[model samples]
Target: MPDEIYLPMYPGEDGLTATIRVNGHDFTGLTLELEVRARGSKNPVVLSTETGELSLDLPDGIIVHYGAELIEALPDGRQTTIDLFSVSGTARKKIGAGYITIGHAGHMLTASLSIVEVPGIQGPRGWAPLFAAVAYGDSVVMRVADWTGGGGDKPSVGQYLGPDGLVDDIAEATDFRGGVGLTPDISVLSTATLDAGQDADVVLDPDSTPEEPKLRFSIPRGEVGRTPDISILPTTTLAPGQPADVVLGPGSTPEEPKLAFFLPAGAQGLPGAPGEPLLLVVSDTVDTGLGGWWVTRDYHAAATCQYLRAEMLVGAATGVTLAVRKNGATVRSGIALGAGVTTITDLGLVLAKGDQVSLHREGGGTLAGPWVMMVQIDGRAP
Candidate 1:
């Protein structure tokens, strides 16, 4: 019951077909209002009430975040809403022709807003610049109604079998075919569904059986981060010396932006000895190739791959240090706070496989504003 659920199997329920004899069809005469809402969205598209059903054909690239509803008008003119995912039987089918449906108390709702997959997008120019994002990260989040079934508000991301018939966290799946029966709680049947994750590489096999494959998957959103790998996690340690590098802006544009990180409080000071010299910088591109010199100040990589490192001061005032070996011996020496922005290669070390990373400051230490200043750490992919 987390905000997301995994559906390795289909239609959470077994032996349940598209139609169910719910409450003796009393809902057939009742007026139903259908609505769909994307997660984190303020808008909801109300489909229909007079017909007790609705079909939608929205343009591609729009992600249906979370939640869909079915409302019915009461005799007193009041309305009650039911989750579309949990609707059962014909009551569910009435929402969309080929989406998954569920019924509760004779009420049915469907989820079949087709996903528009933008295939074969490549080359230097694209909606996004990264080739990894263009080729590998592309995938679909499908919520469809099968001619007989398909039902779920949101697809269960990070859930599916690999081509090797094993549970893979990296394999891409393009389809979660079939119509599912919904439960009142908005959960999907696991038997016939696939939730594709980032790095999802897939090709739907042609169905040899009569059912054929029925799916609606579109590439709504791409993973903003890259898969953390061996190169990202170096084996050598990164030692911190002093002057935790942490400055966000210059390009910390307010709109169309995102940021997260911690910084020192005052201009100078610390808890145990002095805090680590941590640097976090954002750039339009990452240092290309191995041993690529990193921007010393802002340690986090932005605008490219999702690779980043944090530094801390080890021994207080020992070396102009950033990250200290709190428990681990890994350290990043120091920053050369020059007249302007300094790209100190020696200061910014590559992250080692066993190396530990974190802010140098101990518990109650100098706040960034209290000591230095607030630094920005944009979470951009390498």
Candidate 2:
């Protein structure tokens, strides 16, 4: 008798037949009793056969043929020979690592298999197995108890749902609410609609009395060129139509003090000081027909003084050259004056006793209009 035997049986086959031998002889004419029993069961199947070629109808489960061939019977009435050393497929193959064979109805399915790790199993001497870790693209969703804990048949104590693997979906309500406090650090937020309650415009109450202690005035520290002289006045309450006296403090003197009193209407004003007359002379309008150059009325100095300013005005838009001459010799020349414009020139010339000052113009192009001249003088009479 061979140590192992395999039979290619299918779900729709008639019956499996195998030859039986004893001591290298065809053991004929013998009543063979076959007993089928599931593992861990006390009851044995009761059946018998009466031929050396043993033929027995088997059900789906683990069964022993002639106490040698281990048969794995599938639920669909197919049986295949399985043992420790080899498995029976359409052809016989050896059992090896990283592979598994499953007995099915009409086929023996073989697949590549791998064990990542064996988790620690609790024993009498504590956990002796190695701990496992989740691999990429894989996750452990639940934990099962070991056999040491009351036969390992208890319900799962806990389960874990892995991180969200979905993309492009609305956030959970809790997550959305929690994100209200999140602000982007580097990015600018634009085109966002804000609630009316969040508007930043604040109205201050004008009628409410302000406490002095709550009022703060600050000047920021930087280059303000110079420290300004500021004076705080004493608090004063004035009645209606009552005038307030503002006294000038010591350090609060202005560079130019402004006169406060107004002159009465129709009051005659006194003349200016001797050397500072308001106006020396203003010439009447004069016309220069299309000439290249024309001279104005001669101005004789009445006082030995300095000529301060001379103002010339023309009526039409034409270019003109102006010159000031003292006794036929030119004192200033080549001064271009535009027509229809008023030109003011500061002379600062010291006129001696009886000095002659005259004005001349050149190149008045067809401008038939009046020219007016005004002079300002400062000093004493000759």
Candidate 3:
């Protein structure tokens, strides 16, 4: 084996195939040692290969291919190329990272080679391409330092870097340009002033002690065909030592506020003003004689009135049928009074001025004593 044998190769391209001859004799199954070293690195990566048939009649030679698995084991940094060599027995030959070297007898062969660095396999956190693909317009959100008008600070209104790498000012206003503070003199005006041609300014002074402002509102005076409905207004304040006089407008009558009161038991309220007088047209009590039906009495109304009430008393009889008629026709009927029962019926009948009202009754079974029947009519002008 020679002390040092140089063999050219490429780093990032196809692996190299090396053929070694064993002096025209079969040396199959012979173990060979392979050593690889990256340029400028002291530590060398090592592997092993076995002799195999290099040609039909050259079974004594061995073949070796340089692959990426060996190159990736190098440290994470830059390297110009990798230097590799193999040793069989006492013979040694140098092979570049990406080349095919064939050795015969004492002569060595070399070829230009290429070497490529494979990126390390990583999980999400170690992905560099993912972070590189993200740009400003890609809507990638990240928590960054707050803007402080310093290097790499977030862009703000009127502050940006131009295409020429110079700091340029943006003319548009930003939402946060205003400082964090309220105005000292803030004035509020009613929208109604737009049409009324009146100006009302309510100023707020932040530096001084808070005080209420005086406010007054009124409707214009005019002759209105109908009264306008009352409206609710917001609470207003009055200035100190300010006198306010609230006079009712024309045709406006203010009534007394309703007072809570309780009426005593059986207390009579004040009678209302005189209305149409009520007259009793019929008032009579008679017996429903024996076992026969009879017409008790008839009364003609001279003025408009209503049938006010009727009282019937059946005396020791099974039952008594009492009825009332208007203008000789039955208007009210089907009133049955049980034996010894007294009942009062109030009828609300609107009668013209010339309507006649009559009372009739029939005794059930033989009525004893007098079955008193009384009917009364009012003179209400219905």
Candidate 4:
């Protein structure tokens, strides 16, 4: 029943890490339990004891609400809740303003955190990019800020986090509490620091698509950071566990953005733009196996083909094996592969299938796709 402090953090950002100094083996024969919670639901909680590598993979669609509270039964049999409960980012708050800016970092960009007024949470709302449109070594930086920041500061506050939307700046909020002819109390939760170089700068793959954008980030198979917000829209919504990626080009390309996810058949509902097919990489960072890594296939390599497929995939230590399927039936197969001299793995597929293309490979055991994430039909349809 004592007081506790909750520290909120966002993904792709830093999380809370504290060192616990245990005196000599004085406490050897005791059992300790650590409980983690999500979304106010006390029903099922994640636990860890004697930590070496602590990890919690929450359900795909659910936002992570976590706290580590140590429970100890005193010698007298009374249970106590330790104040070790501190919450940080694995996800974002429900509502508020967020921002990201372009042309920062000497045109070298940087990103920062902005927590404005949110409906349910304490500070204001926040925002993150669905995927990293801007890569590291590029002038464009990304961030989460209030929508009301000065126009000049907007770009400074924005970032390409492979996140979904921007947070609204409350500085522009219209407060009704003020009497007639009063200015709104509107305030932004931004640090206005516009972090650069350290922790904020993003790195892009040299061989990514030039046409569309993929927000790339590192998903700690067991690591975590504080980038706690996302944009929700009627047309599109970005969520945790949904991979996001980015491509940094010395110059921009003409690629269009894409979206993909596990749906319950009719769940995709109807495409916002029916006639046009969509190809999207998950906003969540892929956990390539042990030593292996993944990067976007270099367009130059595929440019020689009649049509090219500049695809993205997260590789595992062993190398990814891919299989192409058509209309629910297996057709062609290829190794979507791990990082190497290969620019980007070419599905070498001809579109014509429209949006019927599908890709898949969940890295735990063996690799399997239905690996065709996107099947681009030849623009010159017969």
Q: Would you estimate the TM-scores of all the predictions? A: 0.15, 0.21, 0.20, 0.19
Winning model by TM-score: 2
Model 1, range 12-63, lDDT digits (tens) per residue? 1222112211211123332333454433446654544333343222221111
lDDT of 2 by residue, 94-207 (tens): 221132223545543332212221122223333222222222232222222222334434433222222452222222111211223544233222233444445333222343
Regions of model 1 farther than 4 Å from truth: 1-269, 275-277, 286-382
Q: Positional deviation of 90 in candidate 4, in angstroms?
A: 90
Clashes of 4: 88
| Residue pairs clashing, model 2 | none
Best by lDDT: 3
How close is each model in CA RMSD to the real structure?
Answer: 33.9, 28.9, 32.3, 39.1
TM-score of 2: 0.21
Error of 4 at 142 (Å): 70
lDDT for each residue of candidate 3 in 135-254, tens digit (9 for 90 to 100): 234232222222443433334332333334323332221222235565344333222223243444444334443343333333233332332232212222243223221223334322
Shift in Å, residue 178, candidate 3: 99
Q: What are the lDDT figures for the candidates, one per model? A: 0.29, 0.33, 0.37, 0.29
Error of 1 at 350 (Å): 18
lDDT (Cα, 0-100) at 146 in candidate 4 = 32
User: Which 10 residues in a row give candidate 4 its minimum summed lDDT?
Assistant: 299-308
TM-score of 1: 0.15
Q: Which rank order by lDDT, best down to worst?
A: 3, 2, 4, 1
